[model samples]
Each structure stands twice: as structure tokens, then as C-alpha cells.
Target: MTPSHPPISGASSRRLGFLLAAGAAVLFSAKAILAKFQFRYGLDALDVMALRMGLALPLFALLAVRESRRAAAPLQARDRALILVLGVLGYYLSSLLDFWGLQYVPVSLERLILFLNPTFVLLLGVVLFKRRVARREWVALAVSYAGVALVFVESLRLEGDHLALGGALVLGAALAYALYLALSGELIHRVGPLRLVAYAMLVSTAVTAIHYVIARDPAGLLRLSAPVYGLALVNAVLCTFAPVTMTMAAVARIGSGAAAQLSALGPVSLLFLRGWLLGESVSALQVLGTAVVLCGVLLLARPAANSVPLDPIDDPLPGQAGNPPGR
Candidate 1:
């Protein structure tokens, strides 16, 4: 008789997934801090964005190539174009606006604003898909916005005019990214999360490159400070690539709802990182606002009664139809 191995338990698998999700959240939380550090070197938003995308391009390109080779069915032209448009909206524009906003906003406030993405996602679903909102969802929405308003008022008092500009830009970034999330469900179902992310990032990389060329000469990229380059590389690898892959992997294992709940760690981690690295101050009101926002989002994340628990199409098992072996 052949020897049999013990199957992994569901609890163990969920534990691993939670760890991966937590790790991804922490890394992603560092992004604003890293961007702020790069700004200290007198680099403009475009310059910093160019460096980040330029450095990240090769890694994502390789990922795309690997996924393409493994795919049984090739993508159609229409699919390619759709991915490009989504990439431009989600990664390029959202990232560019966030970077521009960071120039004028505190890292803590920037993260708090970005944390409101789920609200935008809910609103988009209601508007575009004609989804009905439950009474609880409405209350959650109100609580979330109230939290943001509280933080926004505090930020305005502290940072003045710059806060207004930065907050608006970051909020725009959140909205753009929310649209990407809402619209990507179909594509993500067809293409695996890893493959979709890779292709989308490659598209975003090309767009950022062209934008950099239009804005600055080739020599300008070469002239960035050493520290700026270092931070960019770290941001590319740690914040961008690793967190994305890990989060997707976590979603695959634990489901999107659980993964998202773990992601609430993001802003909280940012709070700690900002205080430690950037010497940023946090007010009691800001902390309370953060808690309220997180509570509201958590409430929204819970499934309704009679709802079937289904993992997102993006969460595919390894070596499954949409997912390939070895990432």
C-alpha cells in the first residue's frame, strides 16, 4: 500500500493566510513614508513616480511574460486594450495623484484618506450595477464619512491650504482606484489575480515612462540623488511588488472579506510608521476618526444573512485554470 500524507487543516491554512495578509498590510503602509523620504531630496512627484515605475517595470514585465507562457488561452486584443485602460486609471493616475498629494500632506492623513476607498467602491456598485444598499450599509457609510470629515477638519486646521490641495488629490486617487476595483471583477475572473496585476502594472509602467519623457529629459532621471534612488528601489520592491503578490495570495487562501479585514491594519501601521520615521504627530481626534472609519468599514465587510460565502474569482487555487504553478 502507498503511504498517505495528512491533509492540511482549514484552520492552519487560514492562519497562514492571515500572516501573509498582515505582512502585506505592513509593507504597503510604508509606501507613504517612503515617498515622503524621497521628497525630502527635492524630487518632484513626476520624478519620484518615474523612478518607482522604472525600477518596478522589469519585475512586472517578467511576471507578465511568465504568466503569458503558462496561459492556455491567449488574451484577445479587446482584453489587452481593456487591461491597458484599467491600468492607466488604476495604477498610473491613482499613483501619480497620490504622489503629488504627498508633497503637501502628512503621511498619516494621506493614508487615512486613501483608506476611504471601500466607500467609493460601494457607491460605484450602487450607481453602475444598480445594487441595493441595506439600512446597515447606509449607517456604515455615514459613519465612514463622518470619520473622514473629522480627520479632514483636523488636517485643515494643522496644514492649512496645502492640506486642502493634498487631501483633494488623494481623494481623487482613491476614487480612481475604487473605479478600477469595481470594474476589474470581470477581468479578474477571466485572468488570475497575479497575471492581471502583472499585465496591468506593465501597462502602467509604459504610461509612466512616456509621461516622464514628456516632462523631463533622460538626463534628469540619471541625476536623482542616491538616497532618492535607494528609497525608490525599496518602494518598488517592498511596497509595490511584494505587498501586491502577498495580498493576492492571502485573498486566495482566506477569501477577500477576511483579507480586507486584515487590511485594516494598513492605516494603523501607517500611524506607527509616520510617528517613528517622520516624527509626525497624531491627535486624539485623528485616532478616534481612524477607529470609527475602521469600524464602519468592518461593518460593511460583513456578509448579509442568506448570502452565500463565495470567494472572489480573483482568488484561485494554485495551478487552477486561471492560476498557474510557481506563481
Candidate 2:
């Protein structure tokens, strides 16, 4: 028989998990910064999105092919239909709204808004599924929105232009993604998680391509600057692909709870990075707001009595459990 390998120590496993989770959070947050840089290079949100998705499409296709080969059975008609709807709601619409919102708002604010996805998810459950909310959950939701309001008011005070519009767009993006998460539970069980994500990504990319062609001249995409393409490549590979895999691995190693907890680092990193890279001002109130928001989300993320925990595998995005609601 082959020699058996030594089992990893618990501490070592935990340490590795923390590193992976933290790294995934940072990488995902960096996507906004990368898009901002591309903006300076004269690309619109659609242009940037097209490049990002186009470059990433090949890899996602490869993943889909690999997962398909490993599947025990082919996708059923109902499963295919659900995947199409989710692909539109989750990846395409949500990501497009987010990219457009980033054009008007500071990266710091955008990151914070996306971080509020957990709250949106909770609200969606209450309205759609008629789920009962506990007193603590209500408190958590109130505290979370209060913190976001704090940051929003501060942002308006400093530079008010388009703040409301940008915030609304980002909020819509969060809600759209929340709806996807809520509806995807059963479908995830029907299809394997990796296969589902891969298939959904393929669908989203097709939609992105069509949006780009109809909205803008396809020829212009060929004339973009080298830096634009380079940034798009990095955004696609580093931010999109790498963090997705890393978060999955992290969750597997440490469980979604610890991984999600560690992902609180995303907003914090964005807060500072915005000032350093994008020259956006950072304020004390923003810091406090970030802290308050994290506390509320952590509270909401707390495991319920005898309830199933959030599954990161069910999330199709990078930094899946980085938010309590698996954004």
C-alpha cells in the first residue's frame, strides 16, 4: 500500500483558511479600483465590462466543459431554464448595474453599498418567502442601514454630485443579486455548484456581448489603449477568476462562517485603497460607518438555532460569502 500522509493540524488548517479568505476579499474589492483606472483611460462602463467578460469567457468556458464531463447526468430542461433566468438576474444584471454605478460614485462608497447585500437578501426573504424575522435580525437590519446612511450622508456632504443616482444603482444591483441568491437554493441542489456557476457565467457572458454590440460600436473595442486591455485582463483573471476559486477553497477549508467573518476585510481594504490609488478622500465617519456595518452584518450572519448555514458553493460570484448573504 502507498504511504499515508500526515493529517494537517487544526491550527494549520485554520491559518491557511484565514489567508485564503482574506486574500479573496482583497482581490474582489480590487476590481472596483481596476475599473476606476480603466475609466481614466477613457472606457465607459459597458466597454470595460465587455472587455472583462470577453477575456474571462474562455476560462469560464473551459471550466464549464470540465464540469460537464464530470457530471453524472445532463442538465434537465427545468434546470436549464432556471440557470438561464439566474444567469440574467445574478451575474449579468447585477454586475452591469454595479459597473455603471461605479462610474458615478467613489470606489469606497461602491464597495460599502455592495457590502450591504446581506441586508437586501434578508429583506427579499421576508417579502418573497414570507420568512419570519427575529427581533435581533430586525435590529441588525436597522443598524446596517443606519451605518450605510452615515456614509452616504458623509459622501454627500463632501461631494454630492450624482451621489444619489449612484447609490440607487448600486442598491438595485445588490437587490438583484439578493433575489438571485434567494431563488438559486433549489437549483444549486439540482445541479452541482461548480457546474452551475460555470454554466451561469457562460450565459452572462453571452448577454454582455450582446449588450456591448447593441449599445456601442464593436469596432471601438479593437482600438482601446493597451492599459485598458491590460487592466481588463487583470480584472478578469485576478479579481474575477482567482478570488472565486480562492473563496471556494477557503470555505471548504474553514467552513463558510469563519470564511465569511474573515471577509469583513474587503470593505476595510477598499476604504484605504481608494484614498491611496484613486485619490478619494477618506473620513473618520466613514471608518466608523464601516465598523458599524461590519458589526451588523456579523450579527445577521450568526447561525440561527437548528437552521442550515449559508452555503458559499451556492454563490456564483467572487467573494461569495464575503458578505453574509453570499454576495
Candidate 3:
């Protein structure tokens, strides 16, 4: 495949792109809800992580093989090393922190915290690369954090106790992912998005498996209820694997900017899903906070009039600028 394809102009193509992008966002956001569900069955964060990634390992391995064969050239030594580092930071560490945070926080708050990756990426650019921050971008960050604050306060009031720890853990997850995004720009260009994602996921899967073996009883997996295994399968396939593929395909059909715009649906969908499936009530404060965060993030996401069109391979998922297509 080429770096860029001809613009897909038909209404049907565009509509399919919209549906794919929207559905991918919802599916990605639903991971938190799935984790919360597993928690009710006495599964800890590592238990869920082990089950989810273990179940998904074979699929990820196949993706790695498929993308490797499709690559323009074989990966160099440096590229292999970078994949190891990024796989750890982007998927392993970030995902561990996120899963642990879910043990403490509500799904709504967890989704909102993860949704702040765009802002974290912005700040990382300024701090690490000496990139200039536009004034509007600062305002956007402020607005976004203020909204998070509102929800944080509301969550604290209701959930109490472990809210602070959970919020911190999720925030750390967002920051670690931001680091991955900040550093992965050149690698994505050289390796191709799908290839990079597949290889990186394979690396993470290996690390996660080792961690599970060292810290957990592998035999415990067999004792889990059928429902737990069923949910793990759904979470691994529907939430993780399917969304990555669907979002990338959506980016190919539409443009990245347009596809990213649809990502705002993620948190919104999670909010309703939590209420309907988990019986968690939606509060007015949570609603207002969500609106404000969406406004701020969308403001950052708006493309400049003279901006170069983003490559479909550059941004495989929504919710962040140049997000590298894995949950």
C-alpha cells in the first residue's frame, strides 16, 4: 500500500468512515467498563491484564507477522530497540497503570482521564522538544484541566477514599502514553503505523506475560468463571484488536482530522454505557465536565487552514493528535 491513497469521495465511503470511526471510539472507551465488570468477579488489575493480553496474544502475533511481511523493508537494529522501549512505555506500563486505576475510579472518570492524552502530549512537546505552545493551546489545556477538576471533585465527593490514588494512576498512564506519542513520530514514519503497532504490541504482550508469570499464579486463570473468560475475550477482541483495525481503516476512508473529530464520541458513549450496563448514575456535574473537556480537546484538534493533510498511517486512532493506533 502507498503512503497516501486517492481521496475517497463517494457519500457511502464517507458514511462508512464515520460509522467505523464512531464505533471504534466507543469500543476503545468500553475497555474501562469491561475492567470494571471483571473487578466485580474478584479479578485484580493484573488478573484482568493477564487474561486480556494472554487471550489476545495469538492475534497480535499474527498481526506482527502479517505487517512484517508487508513492510517496505526489514526493520533495522535501532528500530527493533525503539519498538522494545515504546512497547513497554506505550502499552505495558500505560495499560498497567490504567487497569490499576480502574480498580479505584469509576469508568467515566477513567475514560475522561485517558482522554486527556492530547493535552499531555502538548505539554510534553514544550518541555522536552522546546516546541512553541500557541496561546490558544494553553487556553485549551486550562479549559480541559478545569473540566477534569470538576469531575474529579464530583468523583471524590461520591466515591471517596481511593479516588485520589486512582486519578493519579490514570494521569500517569496518560502521561506515559504522551511520551510514547512524542517519541514515536519518526518511527511511525519509517516503520508504517500498522507495522509499528503490531510489533510494539507483540513486545508488550511478551513483557506482560513475563510479569504475570513472575507475580501471579498461572494456575489461577483456570479457576476463573466462564463469564470472566467470556468478558476477557470480548475485551481483548472487540475493545482492543477490533478498534485498532477499524480506526485505521476509517482513517484510510476519511481523513485523519475528520476521523479524529469523531473520537469525541468515545467518552460520551462510555458515560451512557456505564449508566445502562453498570447502573452507575450520571450526574449533572459529570455531564458539564464532559462537555467542557470535549470543547477543549476539540479546540486543540481543529486543523489549521493552511495545515498539511495528515497521513492515514500517521494517526490510526482518535482522541489525540497523531495517536499511534493502540488502546
Candidate 4:
């Protein structure tokens, strides 16, 4: 008779997932700070974005090559097209808006606005995917928006001139990324999360390069300061690439819902980082708003009533035999 193996405990998997997600969130939260730092050197959003993607391109290309070699089948033309479109939408457009918005807004406010991504995802699910939102989720959405409103008011009081423009741009970025997440489910399952991220980012790199060529002279890229280059490298490796892979791994281990819940750590960490690095003040109202936002997101992250639990065997890494589900 064959030997029996014990099933992995849900609690343990979730714990690991939370750790990974939190790490990714903290790293991702650093992007705004780094971008803001770069801005102090008088670089435009397009220039900063181009440098980031330029540095990251080779790494993602290597990942794509590695993943392609291990892929069970070659990518179809349709798959390539989909990956290109999603990449443009998710990384290129979303990041441009985000970086541009950062020029006008403080890092803390930028993070808080971007943190609304989960709510945007929920809304997209209901409208586009026809997924039903429970009444509890409705309450969560209300609470989350209320928190955002509080922060927005505070931001307006502090930086009223650019607050509206900055908030709108950042909100646009959030919506763009939310749409990417919503539409990527099927493709992520088909391609595997890591492989998908690798290929899509490669496409985004190309798009960003083209944009850079059109928007600025090639000599401009070489003129950036050494510290800016260092920060870009850090952003590329530590923030962008690391978080993308880590978050996917976390999702594979635990589910997307669980991973997303842990992402609530992002805004809080950003607040502290901004205070320490950018000399941004953290007000009492901001703290209260942060708490409300986190609570709302946690409520939204609860597993759906009809959702099935993920088995350990089902949570395979990319290129594994059990690579059927998306992160």
C-alpha cells in the first residue's frame, strides 16, 4: 500500500503568506519615497520611470528566459498580445500616473491613495466580472472610502494647491492597476504567476523605453546623479522585482484574499518611512484615518461564503505540475 502524507495546515500556510505579503508591502511602499527622492534632482516622471524600467529590463528578461525554458508549452501569439496589453496598462500607464502624482503629493498621501487599490479591485469584480459583493463588503467599501476622505481632507489642508490634481492622478493610477489585477486572473492561471509577471514586465520595459525615446533625449538618462542611479537600482531590484515575485509566491501559498489583507501594512509603513526619510509629519488625523482604512480592507478581505479552501497540493509554484490556479 502507498504511504499516506499529512495535509499542510491552513494556519501555517496563512502565517507564511502573511509574512511574505507584509515584506512585499513594505518594500513596495518604499517606491514612493525613492521616487520622491529622485524628483528632488529635477527629474520628470517619464525620466524616472524610464530609468527604473531600463534598469529592471534585463532582470525581467532573464526571468522570462528562465521561465520560458521551463514552460510546458510555448506561448501563443494571443498570449503574447494579452501580456503586452496588460503590461502596458498595469506597469507603464499606472506607474507613469503614480510617479507624476508623486511630484504633487507627499509620500504618505500617495501611499494612502494607492492603498485604495483593493477597493477598486472589488468594484471591478462586481461590475466587470459580475462577481457578487455581499452586504458586508458594501459596508467595508463605505468605511474604506470614509477613511480616504479623511486623509484627503487633511492633504487638502496641507497642500491645497496641488492636492486635487495629485489625488486624481494617483486615483487614476490605482484604477489602472486594479483593472490589471481584475483582468489578469485568467492569464495568471494559464501562464503561472511568476512567468506571467516576468513576461508582462518585459513588455512594459519595451513600452517604457519607447516612451523615453520619444519624450527625452538619450543623453538625458546619462546625466542623472550617481545617488539617483543607486536609488533606481534599489527600486528596480528590491522594490519592483522582489515584491512582484514575493507577492505572487505569497498568493500561491495562501490565497489572493489573504495576501491582500497583509498588504494593509503598506500605508502604515509608508507613513513611518516618510516621517523618517522625507521629514513628513504624521498627524493624529492621519493615524486615525490609517486605522480606519486598514480595518475596512481587513473586512473586505474576508473569504467569500461560497469560496473553496485552497489545498496545499493546489498551491504549487510556477513551473510545478500543479500550476493551474492564479495567485
Candidate with maximal lDDT: 3
TM values, all candidates: 0.89, 0.91, 0.93, 0.87
Model 2 poorest ten-residue lDDT run: 1-10
Clashes of each: 0, 0, 0, 0
10 residues in a row with least lDDT, candidate 1: 318-327
Question: Whole-model lDDT, candidate 2?
Answer: 0.77
Instruction: Report the poorest 10 consecutive residues by lDDT, candidate 3.
Output: 315-324
Best by TM-score: 3
Off by over 4 Å in 3: 1-7, 305-319, 322-324
> Is candidate 1 or 3 superior in TM-score?
3
- Angstrom error at residue 221, model 4: 0.5
Q: What would the TM-score be for candidate 3 when compared with the true structure?
A: 0.93
Q: Give one digit per residue, the lDDT tens place, for model 3 in 1-327.
A: 013323478889989988998888888888898999999999999989888888888888898888889888998999999999999999899999999999999898888888888788767766776666667778888998999999999889988899999999999999989888877877887887778888888888899989988997889999989999999999999988888888888887887777777788888987899889999878999999999998888787776521334444433233354233787
Compose the digit string of candidate 1's lDDT tens values, residues 36-131: 898888887888788888888888889888888888788888888889988898789998999999999988777777777766776786788666
Model 4: how far residue 82 lies from native, Å? 1.2
Query: How much is 160 displaced in model 3, in angstroms?
Result: 0.8
lDDT for each of the candidates? Answer: 0.74, 0.77, 0.82, 0.74
Tens digits of lDDT, candidate 4, 1-327 = 001112235888767867877888888888888898988888878988888888988888898899989889888898888888888987889889999999998887788777776678767766775666567778878998899889889878877689889888988988887777767766766787778878878778889888888876878889878999998999888888888777766776766655666677778888789889998878888888888887876675555522433333222222111011111
Q: 65 in model 4: Cα distance from truth in Å?
A: 0.9
Clashing pairs in 2: none
Shift of residue 165 alpha carbon in model 2, Å: 0.6
